[model samples]
Target chain A: MLTNEILQQRLTEKFGELVYNFEQPYGMLTFVTDRDNNLKVMNFLKESEDLGFTFLNDLTAVHYPDQLGKELAVVYMLQNIQAGLRIRFKVFTDITHPDVFTATGIFETANWLEREAYDFFGVNFVGHPNLIRIMNVEEMDYHPLRKEYPLEDQTRIDKDDDMFGR
Target chain B: MSQKQNIQLPEGSLGKQTTTLNLGPTHPATHGVFQNILEMDGERIIDAVPTIGFIHRAFEKIAEHRPYYQITPLTDRLNYCSSPINNMGWHMTVEKLIHAELPKRVEYLRVIIMELSRIADHLVCNSVIGVDTGAFTGFIYVFELRELIYEIFEEVCGSRLTTNIGRIGGFERNFSELAFQKINHFLSVFPKAMKEFETLFNRNRIFMERTMGVGGIAAERALNYGFTGPNLRATGIDYDIRTAHPYSGYQDFDFSVPVGTTGDVYDRYLVRNAEIWESISIITQAVKKIKELDPSVFHADIPDFYLPEKADVYTKMEALIYHFKIVMGETAIPAGEVYHSVEGGNGELGFYLISDGGRSPYRLHFRRPCFIYYQAYPEIIKGSMLSDAVVTMSSLNLIAGEIDA
Candidate 1:
């Protein structure tokens, strides 16, 4: 029954500026923060005796190409099963210089998710111990999920240049 | 820790000549184009690096071009075993973006169909796991039930495998009388079939030995890896998207979230079995609830978005106009982003869509359950035997279509 307002106030009182943007839509709480304080906030959420978000339900990324300002956004959905509450955290980064701190220390499940985001969107996770491509080939260069990638090509493919000789 | 130095191995030492084994983009056990390059030390798997993208068809890219209605068929291919749930999830996401309120009768109908699909999906998952562990008979038994379920789907949607049944507002058509009759038949026989499957695998000593503690993962570890649905619940976390966050009027139904003592292959097997029974119970309840509501109440008020009845289209000019608008996707939809999730057979299947006040979504993303679980494949199989790796992967139920999509 605790509203987002009370949760926001409690979070602000505990960590100033670290609370960031708290948006509640459809009775769900979403907090947006800078990459620098991601781990700080995650650890605080996990270890805090009061608000324990013990379960990491989902983790994924969103790329906003048109906005052009915040090109890539990573969202983490966390659930406190005991409290039956879910909260989302979004961290923004520019595509050209996409980098964010890793949450692997805070939650082990994040290791694969961070790698997946890196593989698809080319968002680099600093301090990730094993930051290799999880979905695509190790030799591949382009990130397939980037907004700039062409879905289909109308131009004819030269047989000589075609990798599979199509 | 900051020091960097060259460490050389003694002459003729165990240098970098580890044998590599490609599991598949074509092997039997790899399960649909999932290839893993395993660096081997004799029979022991030293390190395994999974190679995907073989089955990728650029679903997101295609979704960009199509209207919201056209994307439902595309989602059917994501996790093909449970296409109905994927279809429902996509529709719900679009409905959320437009802030459309579905009637209670429609919600009940959706729950019934979704629960039926969940049962079908889990049957296939458990059966496939059995097949991987050298029990072929169990696969046939469950697949028989799957065929019956598919028949019910075909009767309702006019398609068997890739059924894009529901529209944004409601279903494309109400369930036919024959479809309801077939469902009653299936419901009558399904419990006996489920018991047969449980007896064949759950009680078998060989199946137990092959699965029990084979790929044990703790609750904290499973949660960290973002496992949801049955796999997460198998680890004793009583989190079902239906219960934790109710959608489609799931709160009206009474069911229990089954949990396991240890998050092993056996625990997953048990959890799925229990889920199948729970889904059956939910489906029965939903059908009863649907019967109590007025038939007209099973539709949204948004005429422009929903297809007009064939008879109405002929008789009424307004109905014809709405039909045209529905076909062309010219229905008025708001500009917004909404992430709608359902308790998919494998896990939480989420559809996140961004609408730019257009008929077509500006951006659509499928948070596939199999994709997330496959990411943690290597980690779970670590320190497990080479053969156990295959069983572990199978038990995780990583559908390549969903993962690569």
Candidate 2:
């Protein structure tokens, strides 16, 4: 059945304490590891015939400005085709030097997915071949999705409080 | 004179003249705002690079600030070809995080609406493939049925292109008798027109020659590239989100997933054509299921999130208070993360959401299937003829809104 218990057991047995913080919020298993071993764990999960989570459903990152030291977290969502099982794994890196190894070698789809993570959250995938500003223009010199930046457009300063009866 | 000059030509001009063709950040053939810089040696494309994000609205950045309900309109712009699926997917993700319990009637209603939009989306994709191959008649014929689908959307949501139709709990209101009538009418009339449209191109010699072996991708390679929905099914893997995950009570109804073996343009077209039939069948079953249930049931009973009736809001105090609170986005949602995927027109449209017990989402990332699968375009179209590249792009059904988002 490839239940959460089975997957978690395999993950923990393979990595010991290297993989930790397991949680299942909505019937899907999620856990965390350090940025250094992110690629290794992902490759092992993909290559292991028993685990065969070959499909990379989603790859993105979440930024936590308040969390000291490890301010950036990259999330990888993988799915097993036969069992229709999905599991999420995250790796946390220091925002100042966010250099997680790239998973493009393991999953071909991760090439652009990692670039998007880098483009928005500034989580530099160390071995990315062509990491550049993908969604944003080249002239813009900031990672916009970081919590440090405000969501609303800052350049439009003309709309004062009185302008809209706010 | 010409022979001597050609032999002693400058270094820059001495190489074979390979034309650099920019086939749209603006061309009509791209269907949407996409630019593929194709390096061509005569008619054959040597290399191609696709540049997207021209219409990038920073949806992820914009989503973080908006409250959960306000984000439906944003999702409407994701795959505008099938916006309701995106809206419903977003709602389901939030519902998963908050543990919203839905009713049986609500699930069947969603199935109906979602399958209708899937048909609408495939109508454009398959017919446009025909248009790219110089068979414009099918596109013209099939698009009339898209109007019928839009009519159903208009009756349900009051909007057409970007219908913010479904609510977090369910629909904002019950389906009108007119909406049911229109859907029934569409169900009866569409298949005949669809058959006529199919007869025009299904066995046409020209379409077969243009699409048969062009832009072929292997099953293994497609999965490695994260292909989903019809594109993945075209590679013969039957890995449908509705069948695999069975979200929105898909297990109640019965429909088979149509798959193809060759993973070529013709195979993709065939898969989409068969899927339109499957969607119609699914919708018919969903309507029957909805009919068997009580007519009064629509949205789930989530009093805090779902809005009260307008009459009740005007007449009663508690209803008014709940109305004001929900409308003002003061409902207390949980702090957690959830990812939900729906079978969108293009492929698997996923919404990954994180909430921090605030009115707004802390982080929202849309796993746009087109954005992920479009990465394999240059690889698929490489070493193909220019005309074949156009046909290949149409067959892939790349929507700009979803791709850039």
Candidate 3:
């Protein structure tokens, strides 16, 4: 039971402005950090005995079309197995060149999770050994989960759905 | 060893090159739609690479267009073996986001349904492991009990598989007396079937030898891979989402979280078996608790979101408008971010939802346990026999729908 106040203070004491955008939506401690320092923060969280956020719960990304410069938000959820504390750690990257340092170096589980993020949202994990499409076909060109693409299937039989029900 | 000299040598490689054998995008041993290319030195597997995504239905992308209520069917397809747990997890996530208070009766009802699905899920998994270990009798017997669980589901929901059962606040309708009777019937019959299953496979020398040391991973490595549910418990980690997050009134129940020491196939099998007993205990407790409450309080008092009766829609003005709004998927959702997880059949099934005050989710991601644990497959099967690889895969209890989704 680590409180948000102590977590915020501990985070600031370790890395000052690099750990910013503090918000606790639904009482889960969420924060933003520089995309370049993705590995740096992950190493700190993993190596520190006091923090011990060694468990990499999830690593996925979200595409924001409206955001300028930083259009893709790569989120990494970390947890401490001993204390039962969870934190949503996020890093923003540019859509044109999305390159955040991979977490596979810290956690072995991040390999497929990073590949999935690359497969879906085109978030490039810079140091990843095999950065390729995981969930989609190798022949497919574009990422399917991005906001620019339509959610409807291209092979749908109902061609003119705009005329009737949405 | 002289077989190496008979083969032609490659340009720069030193040791003997291994034979490449593909174990399906369609192999029965894989237990799902998964392709693993293993480089073998005769019988020993040098390395194996798991290539997934054979059935990626793009569930997260599909959730973007669907309204809050329409997303239930999408969840049903994830882990079809235990569709009710997924349904309730999604419902609970939405309820958490909106800060909706559920009745004690609804909580007990959800616990019962979810635990029943847990039993069904474990039965499929453990029995399938028995079949993989060359014990097919147990699988056939347990499937009959699984059918009984489905009958209970059909009584509660309209459909057997892919049941879009409950609404956001609670169930769409109150449980009928037949549903209650079906639960009671299942509760009595399933335990006897379960005991027979354990007797068939528990201490059988062939079954134990096939599973005891095959595909064994240490507890530390399993934790690094973010293993949860029975798999993690098999590795001796006592982290259960029911006890951790305690959603859907799981905190009110008294059930032990079973853990294993070796983290091998046998350990996983034993862990799942112990959990089924725990789930049965939970369902019985929930039944007793639910019997105390008024039957009509199945759904919480959320009229604007819940659908009205067909007769009331024709008569009442308010019911007509509410019905029109619900059918059209026009209920205004509040903008927020919420991550809710439930103890699924496979593992901890988590739903991370971000709503931008629109009908659809801005971004929705399922923390699929199969997807996470399948990453460690290549590591576990390295240097093990090819048949042991198959045994290991099935023992992991990976459902392709959840893995690909």
Evaluate all candidate structures by whole-model CA lDDT and list the values in order.
0.82, 0.91, 0.89
Chain A in model 1: its TM-score?
Answer: 0.85
- Candidate 3 off by > 4 Å: A153-166, B2-16
Say what the RMSD of model 2 is.
Answer: 2.0
* Per-residue accuracy of model 2 over A65-144 as CA lDDT, tens digit each: 88899899999999999999999999988888999999888888998998898889888998888888778888888899
Q: Please give the distance, in angstroms, between residue B62's alpha carbon in candidate 3 and its true position after superposition.
A: 0.9
For A1-166, candidate 3 gives per-residue lDDT tens digits of: 5667888898899899899989998888999999988888888888887888878888889998989999999998888867777888899989999999988878988999999999999988999989999989899889989988887666688687866754
**Per-residue lDDT tens digits of candidate 2, residues B1-405?**
123334566667645567899999899998999999889988989898888889999999888888888899999998999998998998888888889989999998899899999999999999999999998899888888999999999999899999999888999888999999999999999999989988998899999999999988999999999999899899999999998998999998888999999899999999999999999999999888888899998888888988888999999999999999987988889898888898899898998888898888899999999999999999999989999999999999999999899
**Steric clash pairs (candidate 1):** A109-B224, A109-B225
The candidate that achieves the highest TM-score relative to the unseen native structure: 2
Could you report the Cα RMSD, in angstroms, for every candidate shown? 5.0, 2.0, 2.2
Candidate 1 CAPRI category? acceptable
Candidate 2 docking quality: incorrect, acceptable, medium or high: high
On residues B273-383, what C-alpha lDDT tens digit does candidate 3 reach at each position? 999999999999999988788878978777767788789999999999989987887777789888998999989889999999887899999999889998899999998
Candidates' chain B TM-scores in the order shown: 0.94, 0.97, 0.96
- Model 3 alpha-carbon miss at residue B26, Å: 0.9
Model 2 chain B: worst 10 consecutive residues (lDDT sum):
B1-10
